[model samples]
Target: MIERLPARAFAAGVVTLALVSGVVSYLMVQPDPAVDTTRVTAAPAEVAASASAPSLVTAAGLEQFRRDYRDRFGDTLLDEATLHDEYASIERAVPHSPDRVMPYSYRGTFESDHSPTTRPVGTPEFDLDALDVPLLARYLAGAPQSVGVPDGSVSHVGLGIDVGEATVSIYVSNRAQENGYLVLTPDGRVLAVRRFEP
Candidate 1:
């Protein structure tokens, strides 16, 4: 008779074959079908829809807003003389015309001669009508000026005006600490205005 293997050896050989077969079968199979790719798309339209609409404040309106804001907030925290000086500086920085007509509807003329050097702490209300438009526009366009809160102070003053249909913003440096101004139209319409202390 031929020689036979031991029972334990035969059983071990069978188990090894079964394990190899299982691994091979697993490797041959395809990936699962759960993944979905239909949701991807360009997001620009969605982003645009979510953004806030632009404001429609005009140059004239901006001036009025500044006046109202000054009248409302000036005395609580601004030196009158300092405010006038700041305005003078702004006037010097911008181009002026004798006719006082700004190129842009939102711009206004700035006058240094009439600027006030000292305002009573709580005397006259802040006047938007007094703001020089050309100077104000130039300032908003990033022209440098010394105005708002002083060097050591943390509070700074600013102006917000609406001209035609666009709202313009102006910031005064803490070092200058002067008064702020704005111009607005007659309709009393406003879009937006923001202020910060620096």
Candidate 2:
């Protein structure tokens, strides 16, 4: 009976700790959806579509992006359907400004799963313009995950044209290991998703 008493006390303590932890977590995760629109002409759209975001570039969008890319550069090696399937599940799109002329950009956070001190919280851009679907499609198609995998290896896509240097890089989880970046062009033309060493 004495041993039982100790066990009961331990269980009670554990329950109390769990309750406290849950309450603390709930308090911490409560979101304050506040936005400052003092500088903007209009406030943010209240009916932000969570279902449609981060926006899936259709098969046609893919072709247009290819057209724009080809118009500016040359013919691309990327196929329309192949690119569409890659980013089909991008559910959340970070909001972006439309004044920018650059075609490629990224948004959101990427805290290194392996490193404690590394945080890739880039507010680059994810705002797809009225006709920027093709650009987004290009980026999505260029993602390594969009590529086909080999027998023992992961995604191995070799169908992109390199435009020398790029400023935008999107994160693509490389199986169970490192992350990849989809480098894009000004008009979302040339692209590649290569593994980045941490």
Candidate 3:
């Protein structure tokens, strides 16, 4: 012989369990008010919007972005020249730290005065000190030709700094159409050739 609960008692117990689960789920989904949440753009292509932003260098926003970066990752040294491009030099920032286990990247036209957002990418792989603004400029000067873009075509370069590697995208286009881009290393090595179908 076994003892069983009445139907009404069983129904009440199920209802209480369901109510508790619902409340727990709701609490878990709510964001903590103490944390600062910034929007992270997943793709490097999304950074193209920075091109149209103001060209002025706002040190305040840039500094705040750096501070935010430090708060999140505890990174004290940032290498800014890594993101330099001849055309859009003022619209980029690259914050790097060797102490971090995972590599992180920030998105925004940081120099143009917008708030910076970050997302952890993957494991570290790049040599942090390999390139500077002058070196990057030299590579950009020759990137269009190496990628087979026309001699007089205009180009926009954006740098994506992964934890262990640096991916430089050189977007080229003529007066008529989009011509895709070239993926290059910080040292001018051609890593990939991307083609756009129009």
Question: For residues 1-198, could you state the per-residue lDDT of candidate 3 as single tens digits?
Answer: 111111110000001111223222100111134422211111111112244331111222223334544565455333222222222232122446333322233344223344444534443333323434334443344444433445424244544443344654556566666575554555644444444444
Off by over 4 Å in 2: 1-131, 145-166, 191-193, 196-198
lDDT of each prediction vs. the true structure? Answer: 0.24, 0.27, 0.35
Prediction-by-prediction clash tally = 38, 0, 4
| lDDT of model 3, residue 108 | 41
Better of 1 and 2 by lDDT: 2
TM-score-based ranking, best first? 3, 2, 1
Task: Indicate the residue-level lDDT of 125 in model 1.
Answer: 23
Query: In model 3, how large is the Cα lDDT of residue 197?
Result: 43
The best candidate in terms of TM-score? 3
**lDDT by residue for model 2 (33-103), tens:** 34111110101112212332322233253344345444533433211111222331111112242222222
Best by lDDT: 3
- How accurate locally is residue 129 in candidate 1, as Cα lDDT from 0 to 100? 49
